[model samples]
Target chain A: MIQLTDIQRDFQVGDQQVHALRDINLQVAAGEYISIMGPSGSGKSTLLNMIGLLDQPTAGHYQLDGQDVTTLSDEQQARTRREKIGFVFQFFHLVPRLTAAQNIALPLVLAGMSEKERNKKVTQALTQMGIADRAEHRPDQLSGGQRQRVAIARATVIGPAVLLADEPTGNLDSASGIEVVKILEQLNTNGLTLLVVTHDEALGKRARRRIHMKDGLIEHDTLQNHPSLANP
Target chain B: MKTRDATRFAFDALRGYRTRTLLMLLAMSIGVASVLVLTSLGEAARRYVTGEFASLGTNLIIVLPGKSETTGGGSPNLLGGTTRDLTLNDALAVSRSSLINHMAPLIIGSAPVSVRNLQRDVMVVGTTSSLLDVRQWHLGKGQFLPETDIDRASFVTVLGSTLKQELFGAKNALGEWVRIGDRRFRVVGIMAAQGRSFDIDVENVAFVPVASAQMLFNTQSLFRILLDTRSRESIPRAIEHIRRTLRERHQGEEDVTIITQDAVLATFDKILRALTLTVAGIAAISLAVAGILIMNVMLVAVSQRTTEIGLLKALGAPRRQIIRLIMTEAALLSSMGAGLGLLVGQIGSNLIGYFYPALPLGAPWWAFVAAIGVALGTGLLFSLLPARRAAQLDPVQALARR
Candidate 1:
């Protein structure tokens, strides 16, 4: 579970001030699937970065599992990010020199997991993501879909409670993107809170909760009432 | 990261840029080679000069005349002045002291000597029987002139080893008649060869009685007075006594200059040491240039690998680890250069010795250590700017780079 209240972010560009986010308030319970849809420059990525603890808001109160994460130092923020949040980037930012298994092992390694434990978790994650055979391939050697699957495996290898995907399918084709979206939906079904930031309407409709943004403000927040997927 | 991991990372980076690493290594190799070869030349020259001076015989003193005023008030050449007329009486006065072991009043000139049809220029030295002891000369074939020969103004002459070789070829030179400046003199002995000194070979000279030389050269003035002390420890005191006695003999003029073998050797050492240091100093400039080259290469590498640095940082590598990675790359380049330089310098030293046997070409073990230290220090010093730049880069900005 996570909560953000009265979050504000500002940037100084030469002599002018730019407001990136203003009076943002949001909350998400555990195991929810949410989609944030916005046009370019609508502050969706910035808000996602704040939620992922990758950037700090100028003024805000952030509660993660009832602890004030806003006042934590940079190192402590990184520790919390490593322990509770997994990030999936649109470009599949896997280290070029490392194989898929090594990339998947990174988050666990950062969490100070022993080598044997890291290897075991990486194997399970690779198998779960259906990329076990591609584990020995580097990012450059894999297809776009396979690379994104590896990145997702790397993100969730440490078993974080929340997955924040920023346009995870933006670089993939329709078929590969559909496969990635299905994988993310399956993880959400397995009790991981999933928040995806994207501009695609079709992808936005797939989430249980959808939020649309315009001009740095949330335009709508909608929850689908269909029970067929809930039982499926 | 641990030290082992950092070292492994550095080695991998170096392997990735093998050509650039080799270029930097070549630069440092040239720097070290210049230092080794130039300093070795200076060492050889010093040794050669010292050996030549020592060959002049130890504990000996030579007194030369002081400068005089020329017609236009310019200073006269001290050595070119007329002989100071030191006599056998002065020589006897110095010899009477317990410190004096042997003494000789020398008169020297050059003439052409001939035997049969062979003729060559030869130096003629005139002195008492004590000249043999003072000059450390020994007879190789016949007897030296006796004390009785000096009083008799003996026409008997001693041929130098080279002089005999020149005048008689392989024939026996003893008891043979040689024509010295139109006067026939019988060679009574042949002195053993004493190699070259001050460009003149002592083995190419002939020795005769001082009274006979006075009659032959038509001069009563002595060229110099040579003396040997009874013991090396007593030579300094004996020199002072001789200086005092000579000043009195010369009417308190103090016009004579006394030079000892030790003083000459000391001056030679000082000059050589300065030359060696000067050469080594000049070579250090090349080393500095090599350091600059290393810095330039490291900066280029940092720029080229910005994304790599960003990736490492994102992977939880600390700032210090990044710095160690870059610095280790630099050290690896320079140390390889130093190793190659040592090999090149050793081969060069031996090549030079093959051409000149008198010159010993060698590098002490400390030279190798110092060269390696200089290389490593240069690498660390030059790597600072680039390593710091790499460490301070923002991960977002770096990752955004292509």
Candidate 2:
């Protein structure tokens, strides 16, 4: 489970303080599928960044899977991010210099796994994402849908419990976007806690729980179909 | 991250900027190679001078006519203007010391030599027959100067190979009569061609008796006294004894300077080593320039790769890992440059050795170690600023930095 209590984030733009997030309180159960919908400047990205440990909240307590992680050291937070949370982006964020397979193997490499084990896991991830045939291709050589598939493979290769995606299909055509959404949903069905921050109403409604944000505050929180929360 | 994976990632970055990588490597290698080559030349010069000194015979000491160290200094002593002249007796007296090995009193001048109307001006060295033993110079034909009393004025002479060739070409030089200056002398011996020494052509001079040379030059003063000590360890004692003996002979005045071959050689060794290091330092300045180039290029690279660094952060790489990544790239470039520089340096040394086999032109081991160490050190040290900036970038700002 992920919990945020009274989270506040401020940015100093020029001489005045700008609130990027304010009094945000939320809970995400394990294996839950949630979407955050808001217009530009709604602080949805900042919230996702905070949950992924990419940014720090100005004030608040954050607990991921029941452990307060708000005050973790940088290295400790990096380790927590590596082991428990993964991120996907609208750009796919593939390293252009690496092949599709090497991209997926990066997290395993960071974790210092044995070559034999990393190779096995990377191969499995490639096959699972249906990009086995494209494993040796660099990102520029792949289509938008294929690139996102590679990114998905890379994000989940370490088997993180929670996956946070921001504008995951913002750059893709509708046809490719649908394929990416289906892949993300399948991973959620397999018991990964999935959080999607987006502007698409159709994709937002597909999530079991949805939160609406405006001007750095949450406007609504509703559950369409609650997810199973008791998987070991 | 595994060190191997980090290294591979750094190499990929380097490969991405192929032109910049090549330029840095070129600059670094040139710096290292210049240091190696210049130091090798300096070392070889020192060695060559040392070898020449060794060839002058072992444990040798030279006695010159003037005191080189002028205590009550007026104007500097004019070259060749001595307060007093060393005589033949002074050399003979110095020879009497049991610690003295051998003595050869020398008188040197140049005059014309003629045989059957063939004439050329040739340098003449006046010394006793002990000169052959003192100098360890071999006779090519016939016996050397006859052993006679120091004042006996023997009219016989020995011809060097070049003088013999000039004055008695295709004739039996040992039996020929040559007119030196206004005197007629019989050539009793001819010397082998020994190379030049102390700027004088050893094979282009005639050898004659000391008294005869005094008669020929109209001077009773000996030019210089050359002698050896009984053993290497007895050199200092020999010099002290000779100095005391000479001071007494000159009426309590130290009118001459004694030069030990070892001391002169050591001084030259020190001077040459200092020169080598100075030039090596100048070459090291080029390494500093290359290091600055690395810093400039890397700073630019950090901003250009902001997104990638942000991605690395998102993928759970710590700040230390990011620093390591940049440093590894710098290290790889420097180490490679050092390697290539050494190869070029060794090749340069080999080329010098090939063209001048007697030069002894090979870089010392310290040159190798120091060059590599400084290049790598400069590379890593200069990369710190860029590495810090890369590590300190905010992940969100970096990701959004297009």
Best of the candidates, lDDT: 2
Per residue, candidate 2 scores C-alpha lDDT tens digits across A1-232 of 9999999999999999999999999988899999999999999999999999999999999999888898888889889988988899998888888999999998888888878999999999999989899999999999999999998898999999999999888889999998898899999999999999999987887888999999999999988754433221
Q: Fraction of native Cα contacts kept in each candidate? A: 0.05, 0.57
Error of 1 at A144 (Å): 5.3
Expressed as tens digits, the lDDT of each residue in B212-310 for candidate 2 is: 999999999988999998799999899999999998988887889899889888998899899889888898888788888888888888988899999
**TM-scores for all predictions:** 0.76, 0.92
Sorted into a CAPRI-style docking class, model 2 comes out as medium
The number of clashing residue pairs in each candidate reads 0, 0
- If candidate 1 were superposed on the true structure by all CA atoms, what would the RMSD be? 5.7
In candidate 2, the residue pairs with backbone N, CA or C atoms under 3 Å apart (3 or more residues apart, or in different chains) clash, namely none
Best by DockQ: 2
lDDT of 1 by residue, A1-232 (tens): 7899999888888999888788888899999999999898788888887887766789989999999999986567667877788888887777676789987886665555677877899999999999999989988899999999998998888788999898988889999998999999999999999999998878888888988887667788888876234322
Judge candidate 1 at residue B349 and give its lDDT.
Answer: 83
Interface Cα RMSD of candidate 1: 3.6
Q: List the residue pairs that clash in candidate 1.
A: none
Q: Please report the candidate that would top TM-score against the real structure.
A: 2
Q: What is the DockQ of each candidate?
A: 0.21, 0.65
